[model samples]
Target: MIIDNGKLNKQQRKAVETTEGPVLVLSGAGTGKTRVITDRIVYILENNLAQPWQILTLTFTNKAAYKISKEISISDTSFKILNSKELWMGTFHSICLRILRRNFEHIGLKQNFLIFGEDDQKSVLKHVITNLGLDIKEYNPFVWVDKISFEKDKGIQDKYSNKELNFDKIYTAYNAQLARLNGLDFGDLIIKVLELFQIAPDILEKYQKQFKYIMVDEFQDTNAAQMQLLQKLTGNNFNICCVGDDDQSIYS
Candidate 1:
């Protein structure tokens, strides 16, 4: 648990040491933000604040997740005392997928439900559009995919009532098609987890109690759905840390 304080600047040292409550560290590019996150994790482990499985670290991309996981694994040789692989660390979608895989049946989805990629989702949308007697040229599946994703991210439940394009009809039909195939698009990963939590408070409570500490990288890029998911998981225990820079936010 011995850390050489000389290696870390005063601010980084403080971030690494302060592990009791919600902490926010805002830093610009190349300021060693990742190092701070990994070191903080190391600090928690070294101090036995929480077990590896009780810690959840999330990033936006698979690459970033892998990078952080690897950094934590190599941060200190003492990390060998616990299996870092047991840590709940991954991209938002990947983490959600894990949760959904376990409790999807609660949301009326089978355990083996398929997860459709963008191309597969578009194909399904195209089929729905054609079956609804809409012109493919007029209702571009690509555009609709983005529109649907945007709506889902915002947690919009009401069907589109606008008559100009029958967006409501298309939206419903598209979802129906996905259900008929027992599949879900990328957007459904986060949305369905949120839905599962809402319908099953007991299940949500289990996770809230399980994950004692949570950390999010690239917090500025999180959408509404992602924010809600974080809120629910951290509702019971507010021990969380977020590191991001407003200037580097691409989603905003």
Candidate 2:
């Protein structure tokens, strides 16, 4: 038996009951967005529209993911939803990390690979510059590093024609160093996962089949790369629901 918390209004209830392809719920703050999401999970399970393991829920932050998990546990008294191993819920990067760990062999990544932060990333760039025998002042570590990051985010390799410094050489060396260390920076988390999906169709198909339903919170905040990932995930099932408010979206 499913229980309705009676906290959602008519419109929110409509969203919860919806069972279709590519749903978008746009609403302002204090409108029980999170409540509706949890209720929607219950609705899908109660109606047998999807199994717990077949549903994938992604939040932008760990806090949002935790809140959803807590709410589901509270709302579902039997704890069947909470105890299900098939259920997948986490931040986007964390989810990608889990996938990478399981299928790292296919993507040529170590299962125990480390993720480097900004400081570590800068350190790697510095090493690359030093190894190339270039002076740090002329090369400008911070400026070049920022450019490289921008290029990575855009999913393209950028070139610069500064007579004294070679951006391409620096970029190539930086990537090689990262590969040697078996590490990935924050941006590569999503980029490499997307690359895996493109290069390995069978693996991508497995996940597409595993997750029959996908829910994304803070959709408006999603950048181009994130949107591409969502597109690929939902291509087969088209059972995606994004909940966010345009007005509240701080990220472009």
Q: Pick by TM-score: which candidate is best?
A: 1
Residue runs of model 2 more than 4 Å from their true location after superposition: 1-5, 77-79, 138-145, 155-166
User: Which pairs clash in the backbone of model 2?
Assistant: 53-86
lDDT tens digits, residue span 1-252, model 2 = 234547668878887877687788998887777677777887888778888888899888989888877777766454466663457888888888888888777767776898988788888988899899999887777777677766566542233333334777897799889888999877777778888988998888999888988998887777666777787787778888889988987764
Give the backbone clash total of model 2. Answer: 1
* lDDT for each residue of candidate 1 in 140-205, tens digit (9 for 90 to 100): 999989888887786534444244458878888998889889999888999899999999999999
True lDDT of residue 9, candidate 1: 91
- C-alpha RMSD values across all candidates: 2.1, 3.1
lDDT of each: 0.84, 0.78
The regions of model 1 sitting more than 4 angstroms off are 1-3, 156-164
Lowest-sum lDDT 10-residue window in model 1: 155-164
Top candidate on lDDT is 1
